[model samples]
Target: MQSDSDRTGLAIGLSLVALLLFDAMGLIIKHLSEHYSPAELSAYRNFFGLVPSAIALWSSRAWHAKGRQLWMRQWKVGCLRGMITTLAQFCFYMSLGLLPFATAATIGYADALFMTALAVPLLGEKVGKARWLAVGIGFAGVVMIMGPGSQSFTPAALLPLVAAFCYALSGVLARRMDADVPSPLINLYGTATSVVGASLLTLALGGFSGIRGPGDLGWIVAMGMFGGSAVLLLVISFRMTQQANLAPFHYFGILFAFVLGWIFYDEAPVDDLMPGAVLVAAGGLLIVWRERQLRRARLWGARGPHTRI
Candidate 1:
């Protein structure tokens, strides 16, 4: 077992790397969007993404008796979660193709706010005024980023909002799931769902007529490899660090995405998006920090009165 300090450092490092990989995956998606429809890209992403997920599952041997039984027990729930995730990813990829990279990414920070809000009714978690205030602040940030009624606002901007809500719901569902179901197994199911759903979507959209030969192969592979590896990195990181400590690091993806957009697409940040992104990040971080404090207090209370020398 790792010492507290060492574990903290490793977790932070791994979290940062994971976020970078996720943002890199986004960059690849954005590039490939020029060549493929969102449905087609999602299908490719899900299909190829299964590669690393399979490898991880096999190497981990998470299919042993109990694990296999747990997986079978949860397959139905997994399918539902996978369907939700596929929809969320499809909306996000659509937004990526339509909106500025940083803006789309910044809007996704709303997932934290949405998760907190949803947990109240969905998970029966009690929320105090301060946490609600934080969520409101986060929403204000989202409104600012979305800039409704502004000349630049497009209906396309709503895509990330939809995606965030779906993702948040999925997060809550995960919390309600059996802890014994391995993450890799869950990932496998999710990718399988995405593959099936996205393929149907592609067919509805008139199939993958946009394929431009072997050049598209690189983007497809990059999307899958980066996305799958990022999931593994996050699983490893979260295993080492507390979720609260890692939560704030997720916002760092916006920064990475901004840099990538500038380098690859020459896309500059929108003036309104930066301040809104800050508000969203600050509000979400405040909520996470407050929750951590509350958890510690509860733990301390459960420990009962202590005598000091």
Candidate 2:
């Protein structure tokens, strides 16, 4: 029992760490992109992040022995996830390059709404009316932020939205994957695959990008470390607390991105970011709350209806 408590506390800490780490990712990507192409940055992030973990796993003789599928056995599913993640990361990195980190981060927040909306058709999960309303309200707020009608749309603005959609799909598949394999194994393979693919794509486009020195190499490595730790910590977090309780914490990334933008890039957010942030954050919170409420209702809803006593 005490172990469970300890684990819970550790999980919460890891989760917060994961959120902050993720918050750093876009800013870091943006910074690196200044010196390296998106493909170069993406490759470095994916490759370095996996290589050390892979070595650690190898020395431990883990060699993915516990993965539900044999090496390459889960290729189809794994590859599907890999592709989505690859595109998502690329788009996100590109967006950071093109837009303010805070602005792009705000747009990315809509991924929860995408994921919630995605559950209905793809997974056959029943989305209650409240959840539907939440998604709609949240998306409406997104339009406000983007200002579709009044402002001319820039192609760059779509980057985060594209990233969100790909990520949402990948997220759903990840749940299916969790039932089959350890999260670490799945992530390890995916990272390795994504890095390799990204590198090849980069080289194919143009060879040997701005990797001209030692300092750049160090930041690339650091980016990898942050990313890897985040993936692992997030898995730990989800296991600790209920998704509802943990869900609101996602918004912290926006805050992290905002501060980083203000300090380093000197980029500040406008009034547009707040309303959407509030609506999306509020909608997500309410959806979670409504889920819990409905859960309680269900437990009692059929109590007297079907009982003969």
Candidate 3:
């Protein structure tokens, strides 16, 4: 049997794999988007992705979650969170088309910062002063990465920023309701919501006539495969590992983005990006570290005063 520590290590390692899977997903989606609108890509990805998701749910008998119907629960929150996630995914895809893989990944890291801010409002969760300070440090690093008012800042970069905000909002919602809903059910509903939402928007925006040719469809299929697997992998990791144990590995996505850019997209990583990347990463790292410390502090605080020897 795997020891608890061993499993935690494995889980953290798997989460890093999940992050790279996210990076690989960007390249695939970008290629597909060369021929498709973000909506069309989302529509197709969710539609095709459902086939495998359905199979996994059925095989694992995850459909019968707690013997309770979804309607009996907070269905609105789930769908709303799914919509926010859909929008976030859409904007991230948009940025991938307009920016280099690493650049877009770096820009999207702002989502973590945005998430921290939004948690206070949406989840009514109070982030201690330390995490708040860490958020500032992290965003400062992102600003260095972005270099606003310079040639590096462009209209396109804002797309990822907006995506980050939406993701932060959705993440808060997901965390609040995670225990009440089964992971598979959440995936099922979220996938369906994305497809329906994307379809309606596609029609409103003039339909999927320009989505892609056959070659691009292949890329979309591959993207959907990686997307589903990444979700499943990350979900498993969360189940097995403490987030602090998994947090450092999350930065592997940035490294993966850099590698993919050079290998496939011919993007040459630059020097300015490194310092900012390190700053932003360190800030985010501190945020997680402080949050973990606060949890321990609060736990001890609740345990009553210590008696003097």
- By TM-score, the best candidate is 1
Ranking by lDDT: 1, 3, 2
User: Looking at candidate 3, what is the lDDT of residue 187?
Assistant: 66
lDDT of 2 by residue, 1-309 (tens): 558667767777778788777767666788878767777788888887786455434433233555434364566777778778888888889888988888888888888889888888888889888889988888877777776665545678788988988888888877666464555666777787788778777898785566767887787788888887687677667666666557766777777778878998998776757687778777777777778888778878778577766
| Cα lDDT for residue 115, candidate 1 | 96
The C-alpha local distance difference test score for the whole of candidate 3 amounts to: 0.77
Candidate 3 structure quality by residue, lDDT tens digits, 160-211? 8788888788777777775756666666677778888877877887888754
Q: How many backbone collisions does model 2 have?
A: 0
Kindly report which residue stretches of model 3 are placed more than 4 angstroms away from their true locations once superposed.
Answer: 55-65, 68-72, 210-214, 302-309
Better of 1 and 2 by lDDT: 1
Q: What lDDT would candidate 1 get against the real structure?
A: 0.84
lDDT of 1 by residue, 17-65 (tens): 9888888988888888877888888888888888878776665544564
Candidate 2 backbone collisions, by pair:
none
The clash numbers for all candidates, in the given order, read: 0, 0, 0
Q: Which runs of model 1 end up more than 4 angstroms from their true locations? A: 59-70, 307-309
